[model samples]
Target: MSPIFMTLLLIVTLGVFAYTANRRWRLLMVGAADKRSDRVGDRVRATIEYAFAQKRMRRYPLAGIAHQVIFLGFLVLAIRSLILFSRGYVEDSSLILFAPHTVIGDVYSLLKDVFVVLVMLGTLVFFYYRLVVKLARMTLSTEGAIILGIIFVMMVADVVYDGAWINLRARAAGAEVTFSGWEPVGSVLALLFQDAGDGVLRCLAHVGFWTHTSLVLVFLNLLPRSKHFHVITAVPNVFLQNLTPRGRIAPIEDIEGKVEREETLGIKRIDQFSWKSILDFYTCTECGRCSDHCPATNTGKKLSPKHLTIDLRNFLYQHETALINPSRDRKGADAENAEYAKDLVDGVIDPEVLWACTSCRACETECPVFITYVDKIVDMRRYLVQERGEFPNELQTAFRSLETSMNPWGFSQDERGQWADGLNVPLISEKPDAEILFWVGCAPSFDERAKITTRATAQLLQRAGVEFAILGPEEQCTGDFARRAGNEFLFQTLAEANCGVLNGYNVKKIITTCPHCFNTLAHEYPDFGGNFEVIHHTEFLARLVREGKLVPKNRVERTIAFHDSCYLGRYNDVYDAPRDVLRAIPGVKLVEPEQTRDRGLCCGAGGAQMFKEEEPGDERVNHMRTEQLLATKPDAIASACPFCIRMLSDGLGDKERTDVEPLDVADVLLRSVEENVPAEQTAGA
Candidate 1:
């Protein structure tokens, strides 16, 4: 390649790359203010682990190895790209080259040859996935194939370039000499060209060199324009990941003021997302791991989280000029705004798609790049529910019931303690000095199917000799469903009300039968100025058993398969406590459904799915999860959440597995405990 042409190519390619990259930076600037740099130490560690080490990618073995090879190859080949560029400027870029005879350079040459082959091998694996295996979890695109093809060619060109150079150097010395040992892969290839004329070998050298060098620039400029942009953004995106508790939803700040100002309640436009979210969109690898695990997607719903992010990202990129250029929409409102806004609610994202999410966090958990989907979906829902009043009609009833009765069932709050009427459960109003306040959630209080679990929990607490009282009429819904459904206003009202009641009673500890209530009180309530030591009934029972406060001496003798509720297991990390409680019971053997713990499927009741009809799907999420559990062939299924129990029990009836009962952990414990109470004590005169 000529020096003048090479130099011009370098200048032009760098100029194009810089211009396109700067355009992305300004587009990111259009997003809402977000602070991600606070925890610098954790950020760096995460970047090195998830980005440098490719931690999450390892979940899929074949793809993991292939990706790691390509990632490491890029890091090593980056130096080679730089060295080639420098050669275009200087006659002998000896400092940059690993040309023969120098000790360090010779070692580098051998290593480069080995990596060239390794990288090409890695490319073949991905090519197999793209062209042959065609994994459904991955997006198939011509652009992806083109990028992989270019990378494959680059690796081959590097080795071929060295092979051609080896032949040229040997012939220049006027000897039929064997190739040097330092060029392992290249030396092997050079032998084939030993009989070739000098002119042919020289032509091969120019072709290999120009092909390798020119393609580097072409690939560089193409990166920001494709999903392959993750090559540059994934590391930074990992570093900027949200560090909040996994179970907590970031609260809406200054809700009253935002309402008064008539500002966008949620994400009314693409620009309303935080810059970190924009990075999330850019960092998606087009790997559908999120949607693969997503209950909504698995059950044939219209919500594919990967496609959602890509759609929003493409929309933002397409309207970059109006968003980044202040002169176009300076006042944040212009007649041209219609072209810019595009109504994020129903225009960019469908209403059915927004409502379809179970908020199981399966999408978030499976995302190798840490791209979040729940927050984005909820944000869109917030806009539709609060600003536009255009959510699914069923949600309107749930919201109305929440506002009036403080429960979705619209039952009398006074009857909350009726489930434990025979168990002597005291109302918090009557026994405010009790050790722990038992928050009998709406489901357990109002839903007849859930009251059995509620009664069992109260009885177990009593058997443990743990002084506890029910909030009864004073207790309200924890707002977990409302908030997740995108009605932030209703959620906030309920949160503030619950917080006020708890604070007024000077409550310091609470035990909940419902994971939804436990998650909200322990994680979400603190944001509303209500902080307490909250425990799920399973955790409470496990602690009591550990302390010898309760003893399970009777042998129920049932092979039990444990169902992990997404909220209890994935959201709150309470997986072990429930299992431990089940394990401690004598003659109780615990079996696991294939998808348990972090990978547990949603029970289909999360994200306010409990309050409305499921969006169109081939199979109910609960039914799918139930089938997986029943495959274990347990005599009974034990769960720690009311929602899980409800869903699984319903599934049992549907599948005619009524012989396989779904029992709450509390129910199992109550049945297992011996006759510890004296007759007079039980009478409680």
Candidate 2:
């Protein structure tokens, strides 16, 4: 081996990598500051679970196992790479403890040999995926092929070098070469070279050694320039993942003050994204797993989470110098950089792309690196709605209604409690010291079908004898849609006013039938000084049944397929409560849809899509979801959220499957408790 050439190769490649890494660091710093350093123990545990264990990757079994094999192989072969590097400068490649024939050395060599074979197998799997299978979800780039080729070739060279080294040593010792368990792969390969002359063996050894070493350096330099950069950033990104409640959108602090200062309200510019978000951009593996599970992308919407991240990353890289330059004027930059600084909504990202998202968290749930799309999508929407006043025209009417009537549909605020009129449900104003406050959300208060659920929930609570009262007219929209749709000002106004009322009543606990309201109240309301123990109504009802406070005496024989609300299931992980309540009812067989629980399809009512028309797609998300639930061939479809009920009911109507009733979990449970009473009669019974 030539030490001089090896040192020079290391110097050139390492020096280039250093320069590239420095530029990437500067570009990352261009983003706004984000705090992710807190919660040390939790972060380390998460890194170990998600990054090291490759937990989420297991969702795709074949690819998950293949990627994991390669990852573990890299860890095992790392020492072998270091040994080769040391061999360039020294006579003996191994350090003192790891010298060949020693127990530690033999163990290390055995592990290295195994991983060499495994790594090749792993690369072959990816080669199959990229070249043979040509998975639609993956980015089939030439760069990806080249990287895989480098890896496969590198593993081959390592084993060849080992084989050549073993043969030379055996010849020098005047011993016959044979298979050995310690260096199984190398010894088997050595048998092939035993008859070759020393000259040829030496040449092959040098070829293998140099190729593996040089490729290692070459691969290092390629990382920062390619999507393969995730190899370097994924671990840190997983560790620094947002620790806030999954459902809560971080509020725009001091919105009015920022307006007075004329600062960008949300992510108007690329650099407005936080450093963590920039790291997310860097960590994207382009595996397309996020977009694969995305309801919008699945339905052929313009928003592919994978492409969105890649586009932003490409933009950042393309204008790195301008963005990182402290002295450069963004507005006065060269034409290309000036264009790069333009609003991302229409320039880099289409507004339709933003509008198509359901805020379902499907992408976030599937991202192995914990790269979040919902928050970023909502942040950009904030700038469009609040600053530019450019959003879906339908949102204007919804926003106006929310502003005028404390509800998105402009239902009279005074009529909010009318849904519970026949059920004898008390208002918080009438029973301020009630044990729990039922926060009946906007849809339940106004929508006709949703009112049935509201009445059923009230009747259940009345039967259970749980001391609970409704906010009724005192309640306002929890602003879940407003915040998600990017009207932070309106959300905050409503959130504050509601908090004042709840605080005045000294409300310590809350139960809501709407998943959106449950999520907002349980997670987001804390930002508005409204901290209370929030529980979804299904959860409360389940607890009541568990405690024997309410019993399902009648057999309402039906096959019920339960649809999980994204806000409840993905956001809060409340999959079991509704199912438990459903299971408790006699003669009701609870079945799950093909896509259930965390992987459930969205009902297409979230992110203000209930108010605005869906962004054009091949099919409506709700229709697709409804079809999934219908595939179970159940007599009824059950869901806990009012929005989900409304959407699924519409989906049922669209399919002319009106005979298959769309019932709320409460609606179904109340029938059993009330001895199979008709829903209309249950309220008065």
Candidate 3:
């Protein structure tokens, strides 16, 4: 064959291979669109700014810079290789800028050489981190390490070929290429190549060039088939994130009727997941960021959100052929199918891992790629409860209570008003025309510690002159526990009943001290067509202070650490209002824990974990949070959610350290007001 024909044939063969590989990758990635809505413009911008420009990576400055350099090097090297391929074999002198003399070509060669060295060093550092240093709780599986080695080898070979080719060409032209300033390595290699025949050097160049190109193409083809698919999916996931209310789960519009349908309520199989959920599986970088922040994982629980996603992905991949081609039967087919059936008791996911999650959203918050781990977990819980009739044994009683009496504790519905027995609080049923209804949640009315918070809130409301009436015996549990525990059916029943009661009355607004109650009433109730303006006591009190309805008369001089409740803080984004209330109290200096707001650790009370026993783990979630709070060394620890108050209080009690007191936000405000109430005229008696 003529040299010209050989060059054309090589170009055509490589081009076809590249196109075919890329097309397959696109086909695999196309399935990621179902869960997430399209925001193409936003995706493009985020991809450029974040994925390509390394915005999020920059948060870890040293590693970020190293990655950015390597990324840029890959881009530059790719362009240089294309230029070399076009010129070397095709006799395309027009593409060879360094043929005779071009300062720009020299500059290009110099910079390319510099970047190749930088890229090599960067890759080495990354390898160490992935396999040795192991930052972000990262570990390299055997396959991962092998892939890394292949990529490293490909890069080194490419750089070596470029240097050798440049040197050979320079010597052929009898041009004494300066070695001191630029292309030092290439200049040395060129001297060695002078002795080798032209044909021999050309053959070596072709071998090196083809090897690099082939490896790069193979890497591209393997990407979507491997964990490295995150490279393409992560950017889009981050950009198209659900920027809506975190506490507000997508409610079932016709909850009762839908359950009667044959359609699945939540994910029962891999294909049952929304495309976004599938994308989440594909987009995970395996960096273990979620596991690093997981309270359950840190506590030695079997539940690692990271591992949960990983396991699901592996299961899906293993069954992909069976799933796509139903006729194809293989060994263990029935067992594998049963394992992915979404019913927790029989599913691959352990009951412990499912229940262990506190729904803290820490995993969601820390996931750099914006994987909504909490949502997926919640969806699985929905499936478990709605279809499979599975849940923790402790939750059985609560579920029964909620079904029978409309409360988790099985308390008499009439007793809901007992929390206000001695107080001047009016019953809303007696005053059906009342403007505001005080929602005294089950915890406050039934649980002793939480009752104090309820009383304090009532007094605060009275002092602020906010007209509010209690539902008394008419109020049932808001069904927050039942819903979170995965009994969506029970939650819907209670919600419909509660909505019916509220619908009968003329309640324009509702307020509650419990974050769980507040969240459910405010966000979830609307799904049941029971829409009312709702506010947490912390928010209401803060507004009262701001409006000058409640004046801060006394200075409570104590340093207090604020424990952000998972439901109030992460679920509802109510972080500021609680802190604002504390800061408004004169002499009450608010000290924040290291992980405050979105990063705040769970107190292990959400997701019905409060009702059930905690799973075995290295550390209790609440203990971990309490220790962090104690690190602040505050006189008191305050929280807005009653559940958080209960858990943190229990944690503090376990430590046997009485110096740090745990108080609800309401307790703090009420105590401040009581302190300012002067010893009323002693002579009056």
Pick by lDDT: which candidate is best? Answer: 2
**Which regions of candidate 1 fall more than 4 Å away from where they truly are?**
91-107, 167-182, 195-197, 329-336, 428-433, 676-685
lDDT of 3 by residue, 1-685 (tens): 1356547656766677576445434334434235445666766776687667877676567667777887788777776666655654564342666543478767776777778778777778778887778675774776566667766777666655655676566767787645535665555565656566767877766666667765666666566667777755776667776745667666555765676776777656665666667677888878787898888998899999888988877777665554444354324556445434444334667867888988888887677677877667777888887777777788888788778877777888778878787788988867777678988888888887888788888988999888889888888788887777777777878888889988888677999888888888888888888989988889999999899888876777779999888888877878899898899888898999998887788999988899898988888889999999999989889888778888988898899867777888777777666655332210001
Ranking by lDDT: 2, 1, 3
lDDT of 1 by residue, 1-685 (tens): 4789897898899999999999999988888998887889998999899889999888889889889988988988888887777766663464644655788788887777778878888999999998999999898999999999999999888777767777877777876657667778888878877787878887887788888999999999999999999999988999999888778888889989998997888888888899889999888988999989999999999999988988998898888887888875745557335576768766888888888899899888888889988888888888888888887778888888889999987777777667787777888889989989998899988777678778777887877788988788888898999999999989999999999999999999998889889888988899999999998989889999999998888786889999888888888888899998889999888999898888988889889988889999899988998899999989988888888888888888888886787888887787778454332221100
Residue 431 displacement (Å), model 3: 5.9
- Which of the two, 2 or 3, has more TM-score? 2
- TM-score of each predicted structure versus truth: 0.93, 0.97, 0.82
Query: Could you tell me which 10 consecutive residues in candidate 2 have the lowest summed lDDT?
Result: 676-685
Looking at model 1, residue 403 earns an lDDT score of 90
Question: Pairs clashing in candidate 1?
Answer: none
- Runs in model 2 deviating more than 4 A are 328-337, 679-685
Best-to-worst order by TM-score is 2, 1, 3
Name the lDDT of candidate 1. Answer: 0.85
Question: Clashing residue pairs in candidate 3, if any?
Answer: 35-275, 35-276, 299-617, 299-618, 299-619, 300-618
lDDT of 2: 0.90
